[model samples]
Target: MPKLTIDGIEIEVEAGTSVLQACEALGIEVPRFCYHERLSVAGNCRMCLVDMERAPKPVASCCMPVGEGMVIRTDTERVRKARNGVMEFLLINHPLDCPICDQGGECDLQDQAVAYGKNTSRYDENKRAVKNKEFGPLIKTVMTRCIHCTRCIRFAEEIAGVPVLGATYRGENMEVGTYVEKTLDSELSGNLVDICPVGALTSKPYAFHARPWELRKFESIDAMDAVGSNIRVDVRGGQVMRVLPRLNEAVNEEWISDKTRHAVDGLMKRRLDKPYVRGADGKLKAASWDEAFAAIAKRVAGLDGSKIGAIAGNQADAESMLLLKELMQSLGVASIDCRQDGAKLDATTRAGYLFNTTIAGIEQADAVLLIGTNPRKEAAIINARLRKRWTMGGFPVGVIGPQIDLTYDHSYLGAGPQSLEALLKGEGEFAAKLKAAQRPMIIVGMGALTRADGAQVLAAARQLAEQVGAVAEGWNGFNVLHTAAARVGGLDLGLVPAAGGRDVAGILDGADKGEVEVVYLLGADEIDASRLGKAFVIYQGHHGDVGAHHADVILPGAAYTEKEGTYVNTEGRVQRGRKAAFAPGDAREDWAILRALSAHLAKTLPYDDLASVRRRLVEVNPAFAHVDDVAPSAWGAFGAAGAMDAAPFVTAIDNFYQTCAISRASATMAECTEAFVKGRQEEGKTGTHG
Candidate 1:
């Protein structure tokens, strides 16, 4: 460690810690356009220049490592002059269109200019201009506003690992643009807009929206946090202003998907504002909450708890999850499940109490075997890590998935029941390599397995480990990708009713067979209603979707934004999710509804708040014993659980904008979908199925 003084404050930091970091540690603010916490230090902008006691000239602080007894002055006259000169140079070509610019109120350049720049420049020369190039739908660019800090370029080259963006000219003539105006094809392309230091790059949709001061920030989770993530939402006038990563280090870290950032608009879209019921006329009709609940109670009263089933979607909050389980148990239904039938099964004992093996721990594994899932399309961040593991030698990545997912970057494809045998038997060169490697990992998620037959895959994965001697004793080797923010936690709570049906499909089939008198849709969907018969359906969710369309009764529910709950991550870490806003309209938390309905029937479930439910979670599932103790906002480094870390790198995730409901509704993603369809037609494989 080295001791350094920055802005008259002294602090000790690791020998390798940059002076800028030391300054940050000592609570000294240094303004710079190019420097980011994650990216490599360039020191190109010169805005971080500081006057050091020994150095004759000011030095850029971002690239300078801390040294013993180094004294630095960031606001001295000499340092101020240097920074002001640099700022003057930066403003020469800048458009200075702060009023109409999307990044106006929040632009780092504007702030720095006000703080470090002189009132005017000495040069009377013409400002250089560069041609604007079309990047893609999500981001807009005005090349004249670029400061050449290369934050966006570095983010593209290093973080995202896509060469779509780069500086195209010499020195002052340099411009940030794509090669030949080709579409910015990277899945994580939208992030460039967030990182650009000036008004050069902006979010196309957010342009001309309310200024930054007009928006309010809210801390919330995403639809995926059912998988355990904490995120922040910037809202203005009851609508989402933007989405940014909240530092939790455990789940999402200081990173999030375009989906999590943009999907917030779903709260205002096609919402179920009022209660509804299906009529004899075969259409859903608006009804009072009392009328709907009464009908549900009457129908539920006729059923045996053993014949009932409930399924919860991964997007619902933990409160909603607990409520649904209570309702089912009261109705004597134990066949509750969220597993997608017929894909894969996770019989690894504590199936739902799973998290990402600590967010980037997969990067450290000497070997990775992906069984039946596409990280790129579904779990983008994980896929990005796996890609780095594969491409940059972070590790040798192996795939046993149903498809040749591009995220594997260098994958050996295997599928069916035989997929596991290949790794066990070392049938191919890829499998042989994976078998011979140490620190091997098997990640199982959506595609290879669902709630249906995912157990078979898990069995095969375990068998492969046993046969190949790949798994280390007492360590997590087989990882199942969980779906919700608190899916792991909810499952840990043993919220699955004792008498519910086997799965949703089983209940639907029972409904088809007239065995179930009334079907309760508990925060669940993803079924094609066209396959089921005329059984009474009850839908409970924030969104009005196909399930609500077929419902005999409907109940509006609170989204993750309006609920307080605790989630157990797949890594078995407990996280608290607090409410950041109110329910939209006539909407109740899932647990509230279950509590009301349970009280109505004169029964009580043994828990009160999110904390109490978590206690029951630990009681029912001993696998989650540590969950009650982990703090909600706590996060650990990747591979901190005796695991290796990924490279000093970040992988751009899948098309986040395309995955979320709001972005899906955006014309941008729709255009991409159409283009994809066209490409499929061009490939002459329009109807191919995997």
Candidate 2:
């Protein structure tokens, strides 16, 4: 421990603790621009200069290490003059555009300048102007206001692992951008806007929108992916202006994907604002709630319970899924499934389908083996964590799927089930590495569990995990990376078929063969609607997507942002998302819709409100009783056995931007697909960077 005195206050800190950190511990403030707690220390700003006893003059506190009996004075005259000089130099090149700047209310530079900078400038020389650069459709750049903090550069190299951004020139001629003109290819590019200290980089979709003060903020959970990232929704007049990342170390640590941040536009577009029913003309027409309910009742009236089926979508919350399950059970309907991707998941045990080694636990892993999963697209934040782990050294990763850049160094094991079988037999060098590691991880994905031989693949993965001690007494590292935000929650609620019921494939097959009569889609849009044949489809969702397109009745329901609901992440952690904005006109909450329809069907559910519905959820599964807590599932046998096939494994997510109904309806997401997905494909064809 090193003892230090700052402003006549004495304190002891860790050996490697910096003076700036020591000052902050004693309730003293240090102004900094290029310093972020999560990022590496870069003392380039010189804004945190502090006077030291028995020293030459002032030193950068952010990089200055504390010593035994070191005296630091942060409120002295020399420190004040040094900070003022640094602030003046920063303001000299900074453009006077805060009035129209998007970062006006919440900018770090704006606040620090007012407190530390002089009242007026002394020089009258013409201000330097730099040309703005493009960083794709998601980020709007104004390089003229840049302070050269290099936060974005470090974030690209360390966090995103893209290394596409860098300083091009030296000194006064320096500019931060790609060496060649191109949009940032990282899925985490939107974080640059959040890390920048000034208005140099702002959200392109959110440009010229409402300021921070004008928007009403609501803390919520993001439903874009299975990470269940903590987020804050900014609403202006009942409209979602933007979504920003909230700090939660157990989950997403102050960062969100571009889709999570920019997909608010989809909430206002292509919304199912009113109930609709297919008339005698075979066209959907606006109808009252009673009429829509009647339409569903008319089709399901004398139909056999075995002929009725329900499918939950990716964004379906726990409350609605529970009510839907109860309603179906009461109606004697056994055909139901939440695995719209037709994944062969064994919901019998919670550990079989959860990320057993929680997101934070990735840092503790020594070896990792990815089986038919692309964490970069499926869960960008998880990939960032894996990169962070890899950067610490002594961590080795092996991939057993399609070769893609995971933003880290990983060995490419063979492509399919044969490679997995080989590892089980201890026939590879990577398998030897897995056996030698203390805490090894094996992550299974949809690509391995959505095929004809999915059960066999799952059994093999479990056997490999058991053989390599991945699932042991103290630590269980066998994980399943899910792409849907609702999959874990739906499974936790036992939304699978009853003992005599069929899975998703069997339900769809029965529908095509005239064995199934009524199909209820609870926001399920990813399934093949064409295969429903003559089945009367009833779609209850917030978007007019594919499921609604083929529906016989559309009962408009609330989106994630329009309702208070619970969602479980891939780690089986229960999280609750609050209602940020109201659903469009005539649309109601999902659980309320199901509760109302239950009465029409003569099978009224007991729960009347959200609280009652959540209580019922806890009864269905005790895991729902603890919100924001991860109750580790007891590790046991996966109980799956079959023969392995030689087919090559494919990547689960084809397009990262347009995965679900909301993102498919987003114009901003569409633009990203054009500039990133399609543009990259075009670039690949020409062998040139765009």
Candidate 3:
């Protein structure tokens, strides 16, 4: 440990701690730019200059390491003069468009300028001007206002694992932009806008939308992916203006993917504001809630329990799924499934289907094997963690699936179950490495588990883990990387089919053969509508997507951002999201809609409000009551659970950007998807020609 004194206050810190961090620990404020806690120290922005007793001049506190018996002064005249000079130079070329800048109220440079900058500039020459370049549909640029902080550049290279962004030219002519006119193709590229100290980089979708001071912010959790990244929803007059990442060290680590950032636009498009019922003319006509509920009840009045089925979508919350399950049980409907992809997941134990080692455990892992999944597309933040671990060295990664560019070097074994079988048979090259690793991880994607022989693939993977000693004392790295945000929550609640109940595939087959009388879809849109046959479908969701198109009756429900609901991430960590905005006209919260429908059927649910519904959820699953907790459970064996079948593994997610109905309706997401596809095609061409 090193002892240091800041403004006459003495403190002792760890050996590698920076002077700025030491000052921060002592309740002393040290202003800085380009000094992100997660990124490498650049020491270019001289705003955090502090005077040291032994040093001849002021030093950049951000890069200066604390030494034993070192005395630093942050409120001295020399430090003040150095900070003022740095601020003046930074503002020499900055544009004076505070009133029009989107970051006017919350810019770090603006606050520092008011605190340390001189009243007027001393330069009489013309200020430098640089033309802004179009980065993409999500980010807007104003090159003239840049302060050369390089935070965006470091974030791109270090955090995002992409080196497209860099500085061009020398000295004052240097500007931050891509080497060519290319889009930032990283899934985590939206973080650059949040890291920029000035208005040079702002949200293109949120330009001139509203000031930060005028928006009402609410803490929430992201539903775009199964990682369940925490976020802050900013709303203006009942309309969501933007979405920003929240700091959760265990989950997102203060960073969110672009889909989670820009998917708010979908909330305003193709929304289901009122209920509708299909008429004899084969057209959905507007109807009151009473009429829609009556129509649904009439069709499902005398249906047998085995003939009725319900499916929950990927974006649904735990409360809504629980309420829907209760309603179905009350009406004697046992054919229910939340896994629309027909995944053969073993939900008897939490360790069987969860990311048992947790998200942060990736750093402690020395060896990793990805089976039939792309973390880069399915879970972007988790990919970042893998990249971080790989960057630190001694971390070997192997993949046994479609050979996609994971932004990291890994051994590409053959795809499908054969490769996994070879590893389990101790015939592969990486098998020895895994057996010798201290902590190894096996991440199974849903793609491998949704196929006909998914159970076999899962068993082989689990067997490989046990043989390699992956799960032992203090280390359990058997992970399931899910794509849907609601999959873990549904599985945690044991929302699978009961005995004699039909799964998703069986229900769809029954409906196609007219064996099923009625089908209820709770926001499910990924299934094929052509196989629904003549079954009377009742869609309850917030979007007018595929599920609504195939339904005979439509019930409008609130989105995740418009209702208070609980969601469990892939790690089995339960977290609740707060309501940030109201639902559209005639739309009610998802749980409320289910409760009302139950009443119309003369089977009034026990819960009346969100609290009671949550209570019921806790009663069914004790983990629901303890928010942000993963209850202890041991891993289960899957070898004798099923027989091996000869089938190749297949991924459920084809497009990363537009998976759910909400993201499908987002124009921003569509643009990103197009650009991403184009980039991938170009890369393919380059690979072939090379």
Candidate 4:
């Protein structure tokens, strides 16, 4: 430990702690453009210069390591002079366009210049202007405003694992670009806009939308994927203007994927704003909520509970899913499944289906094995963690299933059950590596466990894990990587098939065979609706996508951003998403719609409002009671234990941007998807042309 004094306030920090970190610990603010906590120290930005007693001049505090009994003065005259000179140099070639700049209200450089810069510039020379180049559809560039901080460059190379950005030319003529124009193809590219100190790289879609000061910010979580990255939704006039990342160290770590950041546009397009019932003419007629409910009740008037089934969607929250489960159970409806993809996941225990070691625990493992999952598309932030661990060295990662790029150096294993079996028998190369590792991890993706013989695959993976000592005294690294944000929460509430209940496929089969009279779809659009023959379908969701198109009656409901609910991440971290904006038009919250429908059926739910529903939810499942706390999973016997199946595991997500219904509806998301596909097509064409 080293004791350091900043402005006469003394404190002790661990060895090798930077002077900038020490000042932060003492509640001192050190202003600098190039210093970000997550990125490497560039030390090029000299705005954080501070005077030291034994030093000749003020030193850059960010790169200077603290020594024992070091005396630092942050408010000295020398430090002030250095900051003023640095500010002048930085603003010499910078543009004066704050009025039209998208980053005006939140610009770090603008704020710092006002506080520490000179009143007037001595230079009357012509300012250098650099022409902007196209980066992509998501980010717009104004090259003249760049301060050459290299934050974007470091982020692309280090964190994103894609060194797509670089600085070309000498200091005076230095230009930050891809050199040759290239689209920023990384899923985590949206973070560059947030890291930029000026308006150089602003959101292309939200360029002139609204200023930050005029928007109302609401804290929420990203339901785009299973990582459940924390976010702040900015709203203006009851509409979500943009989405930005919120700091959550346990899960997303202040970096959200592009889908999470740019999916807000979907909330405003192709929305189901009013209730509707299918008319005899085969057209959807606008109807009141009461009419929609009455039509549903009348359709299933004579049917028994065995003929009724409910299927929950991937984007549903825990609170709504709980109420839907309760309503179905009350009606003796045993056929209830949250998985729309017919995934045969083990719902018997939390450890059987959760990422048991948690996301933060990824750093501790010496060896990692990924099974049937492309984490870059499924959960980009978690993939970044693996990349970070690999960058730190001594971390060996192995992947089974698809040999696609995972943004890290991973030992590629074969793509199926036979490879897993070989590893279990200790007959493979990586099997020996896993056995030798002190802490080994096996992350099984939903892709491997969603097939006809999914249970067998899961069992084989578990057996391999046990054979390699992955679950030992000090470490439990048997993890299940989920792709949906609500899958774990649904499982926690016991929202699976009961004793005589059918799974998703079985439910659809019953409907197809006329054995089922009514099927309730709760935001479930991924299923093949044409297979759901003649059954009177009632869809409750916010989007008018595939589910709404096949529905007999549509009940308008709130989107994730328009409701307050709890969502469990892939790691069982329970996070509460607060309502950011009001529900559009005649749409009500999902739980409220469920409750109202329950009343129309003369089976009024116990809870009236969201608070009461939450209270009852906590009573039913104690995990729902612990907000932002991950309840440790107690492992039971694996339910899917069986013999080996020779089928190769498949990857779940194909298109990362257009996976969900909400994302598919957004024009912005659609544009992005088109661009990505077109870019790939162009690349293929060039390769063939060559």
Candidate 5:
């Protein structure tokens, strides 16, 4: 520990901690445009100058470590003078155009200028003008507002590990730009916008729209797809303005995918807001809340558990999942599952019933083994965290998957799944090198294959782990990629179907066989591919997805933004996200919809709210009983089991974005819309929100 004094207050910090961080730890405000917690320190802006007793001049607190018995003055007159000078120098060339800039309301530059900058400029000569560049879809270019703080440049090179933006010249003539004409293509590219200290880098999707203050910020979980990232929505007048990451260091660490960050635009589609049911006249008709429940009750009451099937989509929250499971059990529906990738399940289940790894835990590991999962597509935030790992004494990363392109800076890459057997035998030596390392972690993607191929991949990964002697050390384990930002929580909720239990895809397939009498798809979408036949179909979700379009009965359920619940991520840490708004039109929480059913069934779920549901979920799933203790800080002591064999296959599971029906409906998810725009847009834009 090192002792330091800032503004007359004494403090202690770990050795090598930046003086600025120490200042922040003491709640002392030292402003800087370029400094970000995640990016490497670049003291280019010279804005965070602090007075040290031993130094002749002010020092950049971001890069300077505090020394024992060190004394610094942050609010001294001398410090204020230095800060004002720097701010004045930066603004000489900046345009006063905050009105139209997307970052106008939440701009750091504007805030700092009000605090430390000289009120009036002394520059007499005409100011230099900066031109804009076209950086393409994700990032809006507004170079005139840039102060050349180098946050974006350093972030691209250091944390993202894809240094696209950089300085081309020196001093006043210098500018930050990509080589030739290239747009950022990294999975972590969206972070640059957040990292930008000014309005220079804006989001094209949200440009010139709602100001930060104009929007009502709602703390919510990102239920779009698996990885179960937490998020906050800035909404204005019942329409979402922007989506930003809500901090849960154990899960997303203030980071979210481009899809999760922008997809709330889909909610704008009016198709989702109101309660609707298929009338006896065979037309989609708006229905009362009680009428919708009555339709579900009549069909669900007549079926035996064996004949009835229920599949809760991965996007549903832990409370919703538990309620769905209980509702199925009450209806005597044994065929209840989240997503069926028995192949991934068998592998992860044999290892343990819970998350084998988490986003933050990877930072503490000595080695990482990614088997059959593409972080680039499957888990973008986890990929970003892994990329950050490479800068300071990189951890060894080994991969066995289909992608020739991996977002993480990989240490070893076997050819593909076919290379698994040979790789285990050290045929290529890449897998051999990874196994020999200490503190290794294995991550498996559920999207690797259909049920059949997943078993092959899991079996191979297990055999290789055993051959490499990864079992005894307890530093290694398995992580499966499933759907919904809350997929990790689904396991924690005891929603994993039992052996030989009919999975989601299986239940749909059974409809073709005239075997299923009733099917309840709580946010599930895969049934869109199967025939409904004479079986009664139920839809309970936030959007007009597959179930809603074709179901005989529909129940409007809450979006993640509409309800409060606990969603434990791929790491077993549980954090509660609060509901931001009332469910628009007839939308209520999934638990409420299911609770009403329990009212009719005479079987009490024992909890009146989400908290009670979590209690019940934790009791049934022993893996989650220890959730309070696994909040990332205690990860070094987290005892995760080593690799185990795959279970017999059932159905394939997709990653979060592809698995959920609601996320695909998002209009502002620019990346996702680009993928299937032709197919989706042809349906015509509903005057609703997205």
Candidate 6:
């Protein structure tokens, strides 16, 4: 440890600790623009200049290492004058548009200027003006407002692993943008706006919408993907203004995917605000809640339990899924499933369906094997983590799926079950690497488990995990990467079919053959609704997407942002999202809707309130007893024995932005799809960019 004195206070810090960090440890604030804790230290912005004993001049505290007996004076006259000079130079070209700038309130540059800058500037020369550059639909760029902090550049290169952004010129003529005119193709591009210290990079969708102080912020969890990223929802009046990532090191770590941040626009569009019922003409007409419930009761009055089925969606919360399961069980409806993607998941054991190693554990892993999964598209944050681990060196990743750029160096093992079989037989170099690794991980994706031989593939993957010692004591690296937020929670609540019941495919087959009479969809739009031939479909969701479009009775339910609901991430971490704004118009909470409909069916559930429903949840699965905590599932026998097929494994998410009902309805997401996904295809620029 190196002992150092800052502002007359003595403290000891780590050898490599910078003076800025040491000052911060002693409750002193040292301002800097180009300095970010997560990024590499760049001491170009001399705002954190500090006077030091026995030094020729003030030092840049951000880059200066702490030394033994070093006295750092941060509150001295020289420090203040240096900071003022830096601020003046920064403002020389900075436009006086703070009142109109979207980053006025929350900008670090604005805040630091008020505290450290002088009232008047000595130089009155012509301010440099730089033209704005395009950075796709999600980000609005104002090059003139840029402070050349290089945060965005570093974030693009290091975090996102897409080095599309960089400094193009030298000194005062410098500019940060793509070398060629192109849209940022990274899924984690929204984070650039969050890391920008000035008004240079801002959200295009959220531009000029609402100020930070004008909106009410609520801490919540994102259900956009299975990462369950902690988020802060900002609302103005009865509308959600925007969603920003919250700091959760165990999960998202201060960053969210573009969909999680920009999908708030979809909440206000294509909403199922009021209940609807198909009339005699077979067209959906707005109906009262009582009428909608009556129609459901009339259709399901004498239907046999075996003829009734329920399918839950990707974004369906735990509380709603639990209530729906209980309601179906009470009515003797055994044909229920949460795997709308028709994945052959073995819910018999918790470990089989969970990311047993946890998201944070990815950093500790020395070697990884991906089975029919693309973490880059399915879960961008996890890919970022993988890249982070890869940047530290000594971590090797092997992929057995589509040849996609995972933003890191990975060994592309063949593309089918045969490749996995080859590895299991110890016939490959990567296989040997995994066996030699201290902590090896194998991630099985939905792509591997949605086929006819999915169970067999899963079993083979488990056997490989065992062979490679991935499931050792205190470190189980066998993980299942789920793209759906509700999959784990639904599995935890036993939402799968009961004894002698059918899975999602069987339920749909029965419905198509007219063997199933009533099919209930709880926010389930991912399934093929056309297979529901002659089946009286009752859709309970907040979007008028595929499910609602083909529904016989549509019961408007709350979206994730409109209700207090529980969700389990892929890591089996239980997290809750609070209501930021009420559901549009007459849409009610999903659990409440199910609770009220139970009365219509004369099979009323026991729970009257959310608390009671949660109590029932704990009774169903004791894991629900701990909120925001992950109780690692005991390693045991999992997966079913079967024959392996020779077919190539396909990835589940072909389109990242338009995956779910909410995202499908989002104009911003559509813009992203057009600009990034489809536009890239049209432009014939599918290769990597610098």
Tens digits of per-residue lDDT, candidate 2, 630-685, equal: 99698776736878778899998989999988898899999999999999889889
TM-score of each predicted structure versus truth: 0.86, 0.99, 0.98, 0.98, 0.87, 0.99
Q: Ten residues in a row with the worst lDDT in model 4?
A: 681-690
> In candidate 3, which residue pairs clash?
none
Residue 514 local lDDT, model 4:
92
lDDT of candidates 1 onward, in order = 0.64, 0.92, 0.89, 0.88, 0.69, 0.92
For candidate 3, write residues 31-104 as lDDT tens digits: 99979999999999989999989889999999999999999999898889999999988888887899999989
lDDT of 5 at 128: 69
Task: Tell me the tens digit of each residue's lDDT in model 6 across 311-372.
Answer: 99999999999989988998888899999888888678999999998999999999999999
Q: Give the TM-score of candidate 6.
A: 0.99
* Residue 500 shift from truth in candidate 4, angstroms: 1.8
Residue 673 lDDT, candidate 4, scale 0-100: 80
lDDT of 4 at 414: 91
10 residues in a row with least lDDT, candidate 2: 636-645
Q: lDDT by residue for model 5 over 477-530, one digit each (tens)?
A: 445555445566665555755655676667877876779878887877655545
Taking the candidates one at a time, how many backbone clashes does each contain? 36, 0, 0, 0, 24, 1
True lDDT of residue 686, candidate 3: 87
Worst 10 residues of 5 by lDDT: 631-640
Task: Give stretches of model 1 more than 4 Å off.
Answer: 1-12, 52-56, 66-71, 225-227, 341-348, 351-356, 387-394, 402-408, 413-416, 431-438, 451-453, 466-470, 495-500, 601-672, 675-690
lDDT of 1 by residue, 361-423 (tens): 665567777666556655555555565556667576666644443534556554554656556
